[model samples]
Target: EDQVTQSPEALRLQEGESSSLNCSYTVSGLRGLFWYRQDPGKGPEFLFTLYSAGEEKEKERLKATLTKKESFLHITAPKPEDSATYLCAGREKGGGNKLTFGTGTQLKVEL
Candidate 1:
């Protein structure tokens, strides 16, 4: 079974504060690591796709990195608009596009 777990179910950040959230995963075989940002009552917005260990991607105020067994989403100098639920999903070998997602880490940035 492919499983994903995220730490700090919720996070509170002040404006300009930076931090990194962890996503731990277990899978039969890794196909891809996906990072998504979801707002309240909305679908997730794709952030990055990591296919192998040591892979990384960045955008705006976020950077995502993948390793053999885990991934990290680093938020830099976040603003109130950066607040959202960060979700991690893994596509296992032969699993197709069906992603197994973590519960997610909800982030709240206060000005």
Candidate 2:
């Protein structure tokens, strides 16, 4: 079975503050990892897809990085618009499109 754990289940930050969210995972055979951002009452929005350790993706104020056992989402100088729930999911090799996900990290940015 594949499992994912996310730290700091919720976070509150002032505008322009920076922080990082963590996602730890254990899988039978890791194939890829994904990151997403979600708003209240809405589906997740795709942020990045990391296929191997040392891989990274970035957009605006967010950056996603992957490793063998964990992934990190770094938020730099966040704004109120950046407030949202960030999620990470992992796909195992031969799992056939099945992805295991962590609960999520709820981030609130105040001006």
Candidate 3:
């Protein structure tokens, strides 16, 4: 079974709109939860990493928070440039470097 899952298969928003994206995961000995942003035809750009429940990170208009079995990416007043697919992956202790990724959340911010 997939260890990681993200909700809201797709999202459409106007510039300056705010929203939150959810990521749910089930992992034993979870080492960390990672977030990345991917633009069309481009590789994922690393965003943040959560090491434990209650850990949070922020960059510009994006904020990521984690819990024992879930994570959340909060977007505050997103702009058009923020449009992309957000992906989440999990790393388990002693599970090697390989990570299982979620299907990803597609976000489109229009003018």
Candidate 4:
């Protein structure tokens, strides 16, 4: 079975503070790993897609990197507007777009 675990279920950061969230997983075979950001009561917004180990993607304050066993979402100098729930999902071989997701890491940026 495919499984995912996200650490530090919740994080509180002061504005301009930086941190990183982790997403660990085990799968039968990896099709892809994906990162997403979700606002309260909203659907997840796609952040990145990592197709293989050593792959990485970045945007703005977010940088996502992948390895065979895990992924990391690095947040650099976060701001109040950056507060949101970050989620990671894995697509196992033959799973298509149906992803096995880790419980999201909720981040609060206080100014």
lDDT of 2 at 15: 97
What lDDT does each candidate get? 0.93, 0.92, 0.92, 0.92
* Cα-lDDT of candidate 2: 0.92
TM-score, cand. 2: 0.96
Candidate 1 residue 55 C-alpha distance from true site, Å: 1.0
Tens digits of per-residue lDDT for model 4, 17-107 = 9899999999778788999999999999999999888988999999999998999999999999999999999887773467999999999
Error of 4 at 13 (Å): 0.7
lDDT leaderboard ranking: 1, 3, 4, 2
- The parts of candidate 2 lying over 4 Å away from their true place are none
Model 3 accuracy (lDDT, Cα)? 0.92
The residue pairs that clash in candidate 1, if any, are none
Whichever of 2 and 3 has more TM-score, that candidate is 2
Clashes of 1: 0
- Between candidates 1 and 2, the lDDT winner: 1
Model 3 collision count: 0
Is 1 or 3 the stronger prediction by lDDT? 1
* Model 2 worst lDDT window (10 residues): 90-99
Q: Write the per-residue lDDT of candidate 1 for residues 1-111, one digit (tens) a residue.
A: 679999989999999999999999997787899999999999999999999899889999999999999999999999999999999998877734678899999999999
